[model samples]
Target: MNRPHYILLPVNPYFITFSLACAFLLNLMPWGRLIGVPDFVALVLLFWNVHQPRKVGMGIAFFLGLLMDVHDASLLGEHALAYTLLSYGAITIHRRVLWMPRGVQVFAVAPLLVVAQLVPFVTRLLMGAAFPGWGYLVHGFVEAALWPLACTLLLMPQRRPANPDDTRPI
Candidate 1:
């Protein structure tokens, strides 16, 4: 059972920005308050961080975080802080992560997502907010579960065609 190996082309910077924007908009949907709703921004940010650390770094994460923070109307830096840390973690493991199959990568990325989400939770608690309950933790795993699907969709633009012609060599 060999999966097709794709030689990915260089990613477009514009595409990266577009995907991040889409992810941010996804998060802005009204379903966010529900338990176990995956954080699309975190997932996409981590995806790029894992795949292209040079092109997408913590600075971008910070900017996206600030935007999300404003939209959520929580602590000004809550999302920013979590996203930056998440970017750092992803960049740290990017090399190793790229070598993994999609299934294995899910496990590798799950802990980072969990910790990233935990940052805001802890921050809110420290700032005198009431406990949000244990369900909040499930969102991380939910994001993790979306890893394979995200990888397929996000990498689509960069993937070389399955049938390559002589002139279209990857």
Candidate 2:
């Protein structure tokens, strides 16, 4: 049986930057305390780190984390450290993670997301901040659950239609 081939379009750096900025903005929106909202910035960072490691890595993560710190009014450097670690994890497993199907990728990313959440939690605890309660962890799970959606959305711009008339190799 023959299989159809698809081409992946080149990704624009500006698009990546724009998407990250949008995620940061989404994270800053007030969604109330009752619902567990996923960390949009972190999710976008992780997605880019995995799919475009050369373009988005630890530096972006750190900078975004600092932005998050300022926006949320949380302990300084707390999110920076978490995002740096999260970037490391994503870069480390990017090759392997990308080989998996979308559903399995969620499982692969869950631990990294947990680590991103844990660093801030631990930092706050050490700084004498009271435990924010188990509810905090719910966001990480929500982020993990939304991984597939994020991946699909981000990849949309890079997906190219296969042309039957074109003879280029896939």
Candidate 3:
């Protein structure tokens, strides 16, 4: 079923804050070498890209990515570049995702997520950082696996209203 685009403005800020908190929490979650959690921030951004492109797009992703870089103390601009590219790609494909089944949308986003991770890894390697090894890709796998849940949790039909004016635009 097609979903509405009405936004919930008054409550939107709280949701964004909650999502951002979730992002940081997910980032802090500890996992052994075998499995790593996906970038919760990126996943949240992607959901917004597909369902609320007008509200959250490249700029937000880039800004958040920079925050991540500072918080994580990783290579400078590493997350920023990946986020910029991924957000751009997401926005570019935003319209197409609207008609796609949730599964199909996950398929479409999974690779982009993987590629986004890879870019920073490669950039770090180029800058003389030690290779992180195959385990580095674990986050991608987690991201793909978590796709449906993320969509359901963040993209609920009631969350989107058909009329933009019905709720807050952002």
TM-score, every prediction: 0.92, 0.90, 0.80
The TM-score of candidate 2 is 0.90
Query: How displaced is residue 143 in candidate 3, in Å?
Result: 0.4
Clashes of 3: 6
RMSD per model, one decimal: 2.3, 2.8, 5.3
TM-score of 1: 0.92
Model 1 regions lying over 4 Å from their true place: 1-4, 162-170
Q: Residue 127 error for model 1, in Å?
A: 0.3
If the candidates were sorted by their lDDT against the true structure, best first, what order would they fall in?
A: 1, 2, 3
**Model 2 per-residue lDDT tens digits across residues 1-120:** 254534678788999999999998888788843446888888999999998999998998999889888977899899999999999999999999987888889999999998888888
The number of clashing residue pairs in each candidate reads 0, 0, 6
| Clashing residue pairs in candidate 3 (N, C-alpha, C atoms within 3 angstroms) | 4-161, 5-161, 5-162, 6-161, 6-162, 9-168
Candidate 1 structure lDDT = 0.93
Best by lDDT: 1
Measured by TM-score, the strongest candidate is 1
Pairs with backbone N, CA or C atoms under 3 Å apart (clashes), candidate 2: none
- Which candidate, 1 or 3, would have the higher lDDT against the true structure? 1
